[model samples]
Target: MTLALLPRYDEPRLLTAQMELIDQSFGIAMLGCSLAAMILASGLAITGGHPGALPWAATMVVACAIAHFGRLAVPDRLTEARSGRYARAMTAMLVLIGSLWGLVAWLYLDIRSPAVVICVLSLIAGMSAAALAVFSACLPVAVGFFVPAIVPVWIVFLATGDIAYLPMFLGTPLYLVVLMIFARNYARVARHAIALRFENLELISQLRDQTARAGQAQRQAEEANRAKSVFLASASHDLRQPLHALGLFVVSLSRTTLDAHQRQLLTHIEASSGAAREMLNTLLDFSKLEAGVVTPRPRPFRLQPLLHKLENEFAPQANARGLVYRTRDTTATLFGDPSLVELILRNLIANAIRYTRAGGVLVACRPRRFHVSVEVWDTGIGIPTAQHRDIFREFHQLGNPERDQRKGLGLGLAIVEGLARTMQTRVTLASTPDRGSVFRLRLPLAWTAPEEAADPQIAMRLDGLRVLVIDDDAAIREAMAGLLAIWNCPCRTAENEDEALALLDDFPPDLILADYRLRGHRTGHEAIAAIRSRVGRRLPAIIITGDTAADRLRNAHADGTALLHKPVVPGELHAAISTLMRESEWSRAEQ
Candidate 1:
């Protein structure tokens, strides 16, 4: 039992907690003891005929009150130094109170009446019990009070040499021993409780620290992801600018008369340029998807026309490969983003055509009660069962171990899956090795009116039209001017907005074609806006951007002006210019 108390003495925190618990109840203990003393002293003076006892008891009560109230002077925050001082002061107060009780027990034992002496003994025993309950949190303080109060009475009983008081001398010590054991046990329980409380507090603090660190790590990961997206967008734009120029140069060169060998070499250059453009487009799509910028706008549309369009687009490639191409059309109305659905089907058909050497590819739509499933089937070198799920992963290819650019960049199925997810759908694949493969996209069915007839495809003539090209890249500016010249169009080129505006003042070009990113933190949109504002008329303009950044695309779209991506195909560029010119003419007529 003594060893158990020794552990608490060595632990400063446990000792401090015990002292705090003792301090908390000190006032109540003092109040109860002072009141009890006053009653006992009054009863003794009345019954035992001792008038001096009342005054001495009154003094003891006053002293106890003063001592308990003195604890209020201690600070609320109990540091180690303050707690030690408080504990010592409390122990001294207990000793003083015990001495007063002992003095009363010694001085009053001479009462002749047996009833008065027994009442006095009862008062001493009662006070000891109260002290045990109050100061049990500190065993030494409880012992200080208990021993003095009870032991003095036993000594007084022995001094009387009375036979009847002999039992009290033996019983008093026995009572003291039991009370001391109770105080020791209570102190042990209190120390255990305080230790557990502090341990819990420490654990809670550690958990909070871990939570803060985890939050910081999560924020860092998000920042790194954002940085990667920015780097990819910047790199893609820079690479596309040169490729755009090369494609334009190749188109311009093709128009010139050349020998048979040179023409064949030019054809190879065109194919290579086309492949590079496809790869850049794939990267751009991937970056946009990773940045979470693509949004699906679902609308109801006829599936037959969409199938016919895909058939026309892929028929040329199929014929060139000597493979049969077929489509089973339906008048089924589907709900989804039409452009995204078209992109998914196009990739599936392209993949089919690229892989199949001898057999044909089929495009069909299967109508369900609530939705439609558009499937592309082909008798190509099929994917193995194990690699079925892996085929949709980016840069994952089947049977193309050499990574031949001619076969494709292995991003076709990956793009298909991404676009399907954006539309809240999924693309599923089924294939058997050496037999064939089928890719299906499921879309909800919707009720919609039949679409109008298709618009005519007219060739846009650029002959004799005045065009202004703005780009920070000198090579791009030169290549663009040369390409426009080949179309017999007079063109002016500028490197910045100020130069372009300067050119606008003298030449007053019919169309403005500006790159999205420009010198001095300017953009093609800004250049076009400035030019339109300066001329005091809505200009027919096009924003040609090599950037595939989501914010750039969104801004360009919000401008509501014509846009063409860089490494621009000459035919597409011509059509964009023609459309803007026609729209501008119509607006002028309305005015």
Candidate 2:
């Protein structure tokens, strides 16, 4: 680094470094001179004479220190005017010290002794050398000292006009030139060093500032994400109530007689309602995944059946999109959570169908030593290798920048990743751009075991089933009444826990379907608890909630009752009811 490369703000700093060198030089030069004077005085005293160099050395020390000490007394944070004045003062003091040293040449000028001549010459040479060493950090200071010290000695040699002395005069100017060059180079080196130090310090400061700002930005982004999640959870719960009621009403409408045109209109309305419900469900799934609520219940399951189920679900969707769907079935039984495995497969196969436009989608199985790798391969728009990690992030989609909801909400892969982690496994991907993509899920293969007789479960008939519905929302209570009316089940609707318990006096409910939250913050579990106490039986109950809270869902699962999120599909509600009924029947039969 050069002085020019340094900012103008550091001019004072450069000046201060040069001045520090001068400070050290002052003490050293004075010490050297005092020692020389003592030696000279002792030599002359032995010869019965007095030394003249002593007084001259004393005077020079005083003169030089005047300006140097004045600079020290000045205030810190030197301004431009003050620094300039100090430089001029130092240069003048340097000249005074040089002239005094030069005058030594005249002290022994006319002496005939050869020893005196040699001593004078040696002393002047030492002074010139000292000047060069001490003040070279600033060339002007060096020049001021050396020029006055050496010129008088050069004149002494020339005045003698001896043939032998000619070289001294001729060589003096060359000596001075060499010293100037060395001093200038030394000054540049000093300035460059100071500049480099300041630059490094500035860079370190900037790096710290940038690091702090980046940390703050990351914190802010995380806060925003958390706030957005809270808002969505609140909104999801509020919206689900009406949609749940609408879904029930729609289910009842389906049981009525209708012509072709009316049926088509009804189907479109159902599709629109289904789309809204699907998005909400996706959000609910993501919430549960984040809340660590999904616990995989592992068991021995047939891999081929899960594959067959996936094929049935996505094959029609693929066919509708003008693409082929195929599954290379494997008879190998796998041991894992059957439902969670099915959910993961559904996400992967759905993604395969959504992205593939031309060729087809394939589900295949490869047997490893300990794990069976179920792969979903597709001739879809392939993901780049760089984006393989990002594709699993929530709301991060590939080739869908416009965020087409029909393609998906971008939570499918994120849910898959979360579920896979909860199951203590991982998902891997291999893809080529525009060629195809393959997503593989590795699961533990079940070892061969003696087959136990399976207990068959038959669907429970809903005819004449006594059901009780408890909800604070009137529309929900009315919807429940209408739905059960179509089912031809004798049903009673209650507004509170008291009403539900009161209904059990005469018309006891065989099944209780209760909203999760009622008036005064009462839960479905509370109302169902009252009903069971009144009936003196652990009657089957299903808790239907619009809450996207995973903690509540997990807690609800602990009591071993059926749970369903709202905007519930007709088929899901019906299945849950039938399963709970069959379980109640089995429990009674065992007792």
Q: Number of the top candidate by lDDT?
A: 1
Q: Write one digit per residue (lDDT tens) for candidate 1, span 430-463.
A: 9988899999899999977645656865866778
lDDT of each: 0.83, 0.80
Q: List candidate 2 segments past 4 Å from native.
A: 1-13, 20-52, 64-69, 75-85, 105-133, 231-235, 255-261, 381-390, 396-402, 421-424, 430-435, 448-456, 459-474, 477-563, 574-591
- Against the true structure, candidate 2 reaches a TM-score of 0.78
Q: Estimated TM-score per prediction?
A: 0.81, 0.78
TM-score of 1: 0.81
On TM-score, the candidate that comes out on top is: 1
Clashing pairs in 1: 244-567
Task: Please give the distance, in angstroms, between residue 42's alpha carbon in candidate 1 and its true position after superposition.
Answer: 2.5
Q: Give a tens-digit lDDT track for model 2, residues 405-434.
A: 888889999999998999999999999999
